[model samples]
Target chain A: MKKVRIGAGSGYAGDRIEPAIELLEKGNIDYLVFEALAERTIARENLDKLKDSSKGFNPLLEERMMRSLPIAKKKGIPIITNMGAANPESAGELICKIGEKLGLNNLKIAVIIGDDVMETINGYNTNLLETDEPLHTIEDKIESANAYLGADIIAKALTLGPDVVITGRVGDPSLFLAPMMHALNWSYDDYDKIGQGSVIGHLMECAGQITGGYFADPGYKDVPNLERLGFPICEVYEDGKAFITKVEASGGTVTTATCKEQMLYEIHDPSEYITPDCVVDFTNVTFKEVAKDKVEVIGGRAKPRTSTYKVSIGYRNGFIGEGQMSYGGPGAVSRAKLAGDIVKKRLSLRNVRTNHLQVDYIGIASLHQEASDWLENEPYEVRLRVAGITPQYDDAVKIGQEVETLLTNGPYGGAGDFKSVREIIAVLSILLPRDMVKTDIVIKELN
Target chain B: MKLREIAHCRAGDKGNTSNISVIPYDENHYEYLKQNLTIETVKAAFKDIVQGDIVRYDLPNIHAFNFVLYDALGGGVTTTLSMDIHGKSLSSIMCNINLPDIRD
Candidate 1:
C-alpha cells in the first residue's frame, strides 16, 4: 500500500521554527506544510505593504526560510507554506534569495497569487456577514480584501514540482489538503475523499494544537513536557485513511481524545463545515487508536463545493486605549475596585466619551463577571484595567488618562500604572462569486 | 456539580462571533449533555460577553455540542481589546456551567 508522511511545521505566522527543524531532522517526512496566515495578520501586513511596497509578507519570512529551508532542502523534503501573508510574489523572491545565500542551487519555488481581491470587489453590493452593514459604508477605510482560496490553486502549484510552494490568504486547511490531493492525484470532484483530506488538514494545520500543545489544563487534562512540545506528522494512505503522530523522541501525544478535541476546534456546524473545496460533514467522523501515538481518522463526508468565495475584508475601525494599575497586600481587591470606580467617574466627569468602556479588576473578575457573580473573599492582589474605544484617537487616549489619574486619587498600593493606545482594523466578511476571484502561480528555480 | 468536571472544551472566534465546542470527557454522559446543555443556559453562563443569540449544534457521533455565539468577542479578534483576544479562553467558562448530577 502506498502511503505518504507529511509534517505540519509552523501553525501560525510567529510559531517557533525549531520544532519544524526537528521534524526535518528526525521525522522521515516527504512534505512539510507550514500554515502561517491569520486573518488579522494579513490585514496588518496589507497596511504595512501600503506604507512600503515590499513590506507586506510575513515579517519573519526571512528568518523562517533561512532557518528551515536548508534543512528541508538537504532532506529532499518539499515544503508547502502560506508564509505569503499579503505578498507571495515578494515572499517567493525572498525565499529564492535565502536559498542562494545558503549555497542551494536548482531549488524551485512557486508563488501563488490572486487570493487578494481588493481591486475587484466593487462589483458586488455585499453586506457584512456579521452586522449586515453595507460594504459601501466603510469603503473609504477598506485596507485589503482577500478571498480564502482553496486546495485547487495549491494543487496547480504542486503540478510544477517546486521545492517550496508559497501562497497568500488561502484557507488554513488548504495548505495541508493541497499536498494530499497533489500527491494522491485526487480530483476536485472527489467530495468524500476531499472531505477526508479536509479533516486531515484541520488536524495537522495547527501543528502542536492537536498533539496536546493547547489541550493541557494541569491536573484536569495533563500534558507532559509541553516545554519541548513536538509538532505533528501525518501518515496519509492512498485510501484517504490517515493516522496522526509526532516526531520520534519528541514531546506531546496524539490520542483519540486529542484528535476529537482538534476535530471541532473552530468548526461552527459539523454537518455543513463549509470550505472552498467542499462542505465537509464532520458529524460522522471517527478516530481509533490502532497503534500507540497513532490514531486513524475515517468517515468524513462532503457535499458539493460552494459557488462563492468568502472574502475577509479589513477596514479601519477606530482606536482603543487601555490602562492598568496593580494593587497588592491586604484589601487589594477593594483598592482595585476603588481605583476602577474613580477612573469611571473621572472619565464621565471629564466628558471623555467612548463607544464602549470596560472597567475590570483583573485578578478579581475580568473574564467572568456578570450580574450573577457571587462575591468571594478579597483577592491578595488585583490589577485594575480600564479599556475604552472611540472614533477619534485623542478621545481613546483620554480613556487611559482617566485611569492614570487614579495614581494619586486611588486607594493605597496602586502601582505599575501603564497606558497605551492603538489603531484597530476590525475584520468583516462578504461572499463574492467564485468567478470574481482568480488564482495564478509563478514558479522560480535556483540557477 | 460544575460542567468542567464532566466535560472539556475548545473555542475559536471569527469576526464578532465565537464558536465553542463542548465534549463530555466520558462518552456515557453524551445524552446527559445533549439534554442539559441548552442554548438558554449556555447564553446565561456567558451573559456578560455574549450579546447575541447562542445557537447549539448537536453532534451525537462525537458526543459533543458546538455553541455558536453571535455578535460576541466585542468586534471579533482584531478589534477586541480583551487580553485573551481570540476568545480561546472563553470555552473554559463554557465548561464552568453548573450541571445537574449525572446520577439523577
Candidate 2:
C-alpha cells in the first residue's frame, strides 16, 4: 500500500510550538504542515515589515523553524507551512539561514510569492464578493491585499523537491493539499481525490482542534491529557482515502466524534465546500472507528472549483481599547456590574468618544447576549471587561484607561486592572478573476 | 432534553458571516434536531445577534446541519467590539434550543 503520513504542526500564528517538536521527533510522519496565517495577521506582519525589513514574516517563524527543522531534517521529513505569512521570501531566507546554522548546507527551500497584490489591488474594488458595496470606497485605507492562492502553485514548488516550502497567503487547506497532490501525483482535475486530500488537509489544518484540544467538556465529551495535547497526522492512501491519528504515546484521541466536529468546522456548505483547489463535498462522509485513536474517513467527493479567487484586503479600520478587572466571592456579579457601570460613567464623564463600547461581566452571559439568564444570577467570581472601538487612538486609549482607574476607585476587591490600546486592521473580501493574477513559485538553496 | 444535550457543535466565522454546525451526539437524535432545529428556530434563538438571513444546509450522513448566519459577526473577527469577536462561543449557545426527548 502506497501511503503518505502527513502531520499537522501548528494551527494558528501563535499556537503552541512544542507539540510540533513532539510531532517531528516521534510522529513518524513524511511531511509536516503548519497553518499559521489568518487574514489580519498578514497585515500586521506587513506593518512589521514596513517598520523593519527583517521583521515582516511570522514573528515566531525563526523560533519554530529553529526548533523543528533539525529534527525534520534528521527524520528526512519535509516541512510545509504558511508561516511565510506576509513575507515568504524573507521567511524562506530565514529558514535557509537556520539551515546553514544547523550545518544542513544541502537544504533546499522553496518560497511561493505572487499572492500579495498590494500594487495590483486596483484589480479588485470593482465589487465585493458578498455585498453590493464598491470595494474602492476604502481604497486609500487599504494597507495590504493578498489573494488566497490555490494548491497548484504549492504543487509547483513541490516539483523542485525542496526540503521545506514556505508560502504566503495560500489557502490553509492548500498548504496540505499541495503535498498530497505532489506525492500522489494527482491532477487538479481529480476532483474526488482532490476533495479527499482537501478534507484530510482541513482536518489537519487546525492541528489540535481535531485532536481533542477544543473538543473537551467535563462529564460529557472528556478528552484525556489535554494539557499536553499532541498534533494530528493523516495517512493518505494513493486513492485519497485517509485516517487521522496522533503521535504514539502522546495525548488526545481521534474518533468519529472528533473527526465529525472538525470536518464541519468552518465549512459553509457540505455538498460544495469551496476552495481554490476543489469544491469539496462532505455530506456523505463517514467516519468509521477502525481502531482505538484511529478513524477511517470515507465518502469525500468533489466538483470543480470556481474560476475566481478570494482576496482578503486588510485596511486600517480604527483602534481598540480594552481593560479588565476582577471581583470574587459572593455577590460577585453585582459587584462586577457596579464596577462596569462606574467605568462606563467615568468614560462618558471624560467624554471619550467611541463608535461603540461594551462592558461585560465575564462568566455571566458575556457570549450569548440577551439570551442568557446567568447575567441575573450570582457567580462566584466575575471579571469586568470593558472594550470599545474609536476612530481616534487617544479615545481608544481612554476607554481602557478609565477601566484601569477602578484599582483605586469604584469596586472594593478590584484587581488585575489591565489596559491596552492598539490599531486595528480590518479585513474585507473581494473576488478576482482567475486570469488576473499569476501565482509565482521560486526555489532557493541554503546559503 | 435540550439541543445541547443531544448535540455538540463548533462555530466558525469569515467576514461578517458565521457558520455553526450542530451534530447530534447520538445518531438517534438526528431526526429530532432536523425537525426542531429549523431555520426559524435558529433565527428566533439568535434574533438578538443575527442581523442577516439564515440559511441551513443538511449533512445527513454526518447527522448534522450547518446554519449560516450572515451579518452576525458584528463585522467579523478583525473588527468587533464583542469580547468573543470570533463568535467562537456561539456554538454552545446554539445548543441551548429545546429538543424533544421522544420523536416519531
DockQ of 1: 0.64
Q: Per-residue alpha-carbon lDDT of model 1 for A1-447, expressed as tens digits? A: 668899999888889888899999998899999888887888899998999887799888899789888889887899998888888888898899899999998899999999999989874688888779888998888998999999999988888889999998988888888888888888889998899999899888889999888899877888878888999999988889898998866888888878888888888878998888899899898888888788989888899899999999988988999999999999888788888888888888888878888887787567655533546777678899999888899988998787787888778778999999999987888999999888898987788
The list of candidate 1 runs beyond 4 A from truth reads A371-375
Cα lDDT tens digits, model 2, A1-447, are 678888899999999998999988888888999899986899999888888877778888888988999999888888999888888988888888888888886889989988888887774547766566798888888888899999999888888878898988988999989888888888889888888888888888999999998898787799999888999989999987888898877888788889888988887877888888878888778889888888899888888888888888888988999999999997777889898999889888989888889887778867766766453556688889999999999999888878888888887888878888889898888878888877777778864
lDDT of each: 0.86, 0.85
Give one digit per residue, the lDDT tens place, for model 2 in B39-83: 988888898888999999988887878898899988888888888
- Compared with the true structure, what per-residue lDDT tens digits does model 1 show for residues B1-104? 98888888889877777898888888889899888888888978888888888899888877878889987787778877677688888887887789888884
Best by lDDT: 1
**Top DockQ model:** 2
TM for every model, in the order presented, reads 0.96, 0.95
Query: What fraction of the true interface does each of the listed models get right, in terms of native contacts kept?
Result: 0.59, 0.75
Computed on C-alphas against the true complex, the DockQ of each candidate is 0.64, 0.74
